[model samples]
Target chain A: MISVLLIGKGNIATHLFEAFSNLKEIKVTQINSRELDNIPNADITIIAVSDDAIAEVSNKINNNFVVHTSGSFAMTHLKNKTRKGVFYMLQTFTKNKKVDFSKVPFCLEAEDKNDYQLLEKLAKLLSEHNYNIDSEQRKRLHVAAVFVNNFTNHMYKIGNDICKENNIPFKILGPLIDETASKIKTLSPEKAQTGPAIRNDEETIKNHLNLLSENNKEIYKLLTKSIQNGN
Target chain B: MISVLLIGKGNIATHLFEAFSNLKEIKVTQINSRELDNIPNADITIIAVSDDAIAEVSNKINNNFVVHTSGSFAMTHLKNKTRKGVFYMLQTFTKNKKVDFSKVPFCLEAEDKNDYQLLEKLAKLLSEHNYNIDSEQRKRLHVAAVFVNNFTNHMYKIGNDICKENNIPFKILGPLIDETASKIKTLSPEKAQTGPAIRNDEETIKNHLNLLSENNKEIYKLLTKSIQNGN
Candidate 1:
């Protein structure tokens, strides 16, 4: 059985706490980051706080195994005198949205094989997807996450804005957005790509440019150039 | 019963033909865009040929009602001396992919009320999403589609490139990509935005910028600014 003391009351923390509570092999205790004076004894100490609070929170923990749930922060940065690791879930977390933990990719990092195996064992109990990713790789994965998640969401925002300006319902683009994401599962993004930018249809491209606002025109031109360069 | 003649053997033409062939109330005949000389006698003639070929294809058709499936092409451009309309389907059609016709937004336009009603009736037989979008609005929607579908797919391509470089299996990002698309269904993209860009986390943003290549850095910075500005 694994005894876990989970710290922080944030979105990730709350979700992790709920997930761990359901595992028969996991005896989990949750505490707010502010109430760190009395740190509970456990097989693992997980600090699921903000990126900035990770170091300070880890410094206060005196557990056998200490791990922070951060993508960018390295496991080596943990100030705990004992063993250090990372328990980063690579999916976004929201307070109200119920996450399907089984699909969430748990990116685990540890100093040694035994610690890595322990984290892997625990991760398997909650999810089928787990990776033994080190700090350097995790940092790169986080940047990639920014592109796929943050930047992609920005594209949707711009699409919504364009539709709104022209009195078109944004939801009309819903199926296309879903299919765009779904297409990558079977085909590589390079192969799945479509539209005038890739085809270099100058007439259609010219017409599209005239319809955009000044700010969007800058974005349209830049992305068009990038897609053409295939970078 | 409606008799329809579909021109062109392209992706959209093939998909529409397959769909229309199964309907009990419709008799659909598909011919190559090059075979416009033998004009088929049908109630509605749909020229699904290339944008450049729309005028030439419609010119050969003496059908009572004619339409072209080009998003940017105006309904009045069809040279069928009788009546003209547009049967624009605002979704990307790939050769191998099976499209859910019910979800495809059919943006129909016509010169008169009777022609509009006829196009609407045909659209309703196949899809639940039917919009009476004129030439100008259809043109705007097409641009918005470029943002949501084309530019967004580019983001996935870059994300895949970053993962491939770092030896991270791009499939690990599959769930995150799916979630990002699904989130916007319930929340507006403005409210759905997350990550360092939205938070204005300069430290994380700087780290991300440092990690990107020169070409990607340009895109990352521009998108970051756009998201920050809430555009």
Candidate 2:
């Protein structure tokens, strides 16, 4: 059995705790970040905290196998005298949603081969998809994630605002959003991209810009220019 | 059987032809836009051509019930002396992809009540999700779609570019994209929003901006500002 100690009380920590506790082979203990001095002994201590708090929180941990769950942070940020690693899950966790961990990609990195194997084993228990990624690669993955998840959701917000302004239900655009996301699974995003920008439909682009506010018009022009440049 | 004539060789027309052809109750005759003079008489003639071509193409039609498939174009743009209507499917179509029309939302409009009923009946035959939306609402829906479909896909493109530059496989972000899209179905986009901008984490936002290129940096700043303003 693998004994794991999870730190932090954020979305990722809560979800990880629930997921780990559900596994018969894994015995999990979760605690809030403020109670760092009362750290318990475990085979691996995983710190799932905010980016700004990762280094500070990890410094309080005194464990042989200490790993921080952050894609953007390097493994060296753990500041643990003992063995250190990263068990980062590439996902956007919400408080209320039940995440299917099997679908999530786990990016694992460690200072030692044995620690890497331990993180990999733990990742396998939760997810079928795991990658042996270095810190640099993980940082890049996080940036890509910001674009796909954060930026994409911002686009949905813009769509919702437009629907509200026009007195239309925002749910009408839901199917289109799903289809667009699903298409990229099979086709490259560049090839999957279709719009007035890609088609160079200046009239439609002009009309759309007319409907948007000042800030949105700036965004519309910049992204349109980017898409037109094929970058 | 509801005999229909679909004119256009574009993505929308082709997909509509394939979907309508599968139904036993709907008899669809599809022809290229150039063959408008040879248009056969049918219960309804659908001009699924470009927005610019809708006026010129529908003018040639002599059918009693003529409609153009466009979200932005108004029902009056049909220019048919006969009864005119609009059948706008609110979803993106790709040339190689086989779209499941049942999941697509059909926005229907007509000048006459009987013609509206006829369009609604045909929409029901093609899709389970149908809405009785007028030209004004349909125009707003089109703009909303540009945000959700076109703009959202552009985000995917940016993510892909980031992954490519970092030597990472773009498919890794697929699950994140899917989840972001799925969450909006149940929760409002504003509530579902996450990341540095929403959290007001200036530090992480600065780090992300530093990682982005000059053009991407502009986008990052603009979107961050928009999200910060809660617009």
Candidate 3:
């Protein structure tokens, strides 16, 4: 059994805790930075803290296989570590519900081949459902993720608010919302894009704009122009 | 059985054809402009044409309780005609599938009391699984949908492109995407917004900008500024 030590109690760490707890072949222990006395020596020590806390905490742990769980942070952030790597889950995390890490993509980064092999095996176990990625790729992926997930969801929020203001049931847009998401799976977004803006239907665009509040109107104008010019 | 004459063969009409086809209580005769020769005289005629075409088509139909399926276009668009009303489906429709309109929303608008009751009954029947909205409210909702459904989905597309170029599997953002969507159902978008741009994490934001393509960089900057300034 691979013994793992986790440091942190945030969303990602919590999910990791639950996942590791259920794993039959892994023995995992969590360390609270606030109560460092509980920390135990283990085969793998994972620093799943905030980006700012990585270096300070990495320095505290003496000579264990250390890995940090961050996509944006460089692996060198764990400089004091002997067995150094990254165990970044390339997906967002939330606290209330359990995440299916099995399907989640794991971005594994390690300097030594043996360490890489160990993390790879651990990642693969999770990979029965999750994806196994690496640091360099994880950074790129994280950047893209912000665009699709974070930014897109924001747009949905805007849509919901607009519906509420107009007294149109937000449910009216559900199918379109779901379809927009599903289409990207089969087609490149560029190819699947459709709307007054993309069609350059200035009349419809103008009508839609006239209907918008000042703030929404600004967003509408900007996005319309962007999509029209193919930016 | 209600004999319904369905006009237009665009996205909404095509789906309506598929959905209404299975209902035993309703007999639908669909008319694409190309199939105008077969326009059936029936109890009700639903003009499911483009916004610009609503007036022209309403003028062509003679002495039937005619309703145009448009959210933004007011009832006045059908003003000159007798026995006029609006049967707007407040949901987005695509050509590939039939959505369960019972759970969707149907916005009913009519001038005459008896026709209004009939329209309301029809709407109630369809909305057994959907929502019922008033025209004024639906128009407002349609505007909001422009923000949430159309605008948000476009942002997702843009974000996905960023991932594609960066060799990141866009799938990684699925959880975040779903969470963002699900969150707004319970919270206002402005309150739920989280990210480097919102927090003004200058270091991370700068790092992200460096990673983006020139076009995406421009988008990142524009949207980031918009979100930050609440413009």
Number of the top lDDT candidate: 1
Candidate that would win on TM-score: 1
Alpha carbon lDDT at A8, candidate 3: 90
Tens digits of per-residue lDDT for model 2, A19-87: 998999999999999888779989999998888888888777778889998878888877878899998
Q: Candidate 1 docking category?
A: high
DockQ, computed on Cα atoms, for candidate 1: 0.88
RMSD of 2: 1.3
User: How well does candidate 3 score on lDDT at residue B61?
Assistant: 75
Comparing 1 and 2 by lDDT, which wins?
A: 1
lDDT score at residue A67, model 1, on the 0-100 scale: 92
Q: Estimate the overall C-alpha local distance difference test score of candidate 1.
A: 0.91
Taking the tens digit of each residue's C-alpha lDDT, what string does model 3 give over B1-231? 777888888888888777778788788888875565546788778888888788877777774698888867778767435687888775555557557676566667777888877777766666753354556666676666666656666777777776667666666666566666665555566766767778788888898889876867877787777778764
Using Cα atoms with residue i matched to residue i, what is each candidate's TM-score against the true structure? 0.98, 0.97, 0.90
What residue runs in model 1 are displaced by over 4 Å at the alpha carbon?
none
Best by DockQ: 1
Off by over 4 Å in 2: none
Off by over 4 Å in 3: A34-39, A127-129, A168-172, B34-39, B98-103, B123-132, B186-191, B229-231
Docking quality class, candidate 3: medium
- Give lDDT tens digits, candidate 1, residues B81-115: 98889999989888878878998999999898998
What lDDT, from 0 to 1, does candidate 2 have? 0.86
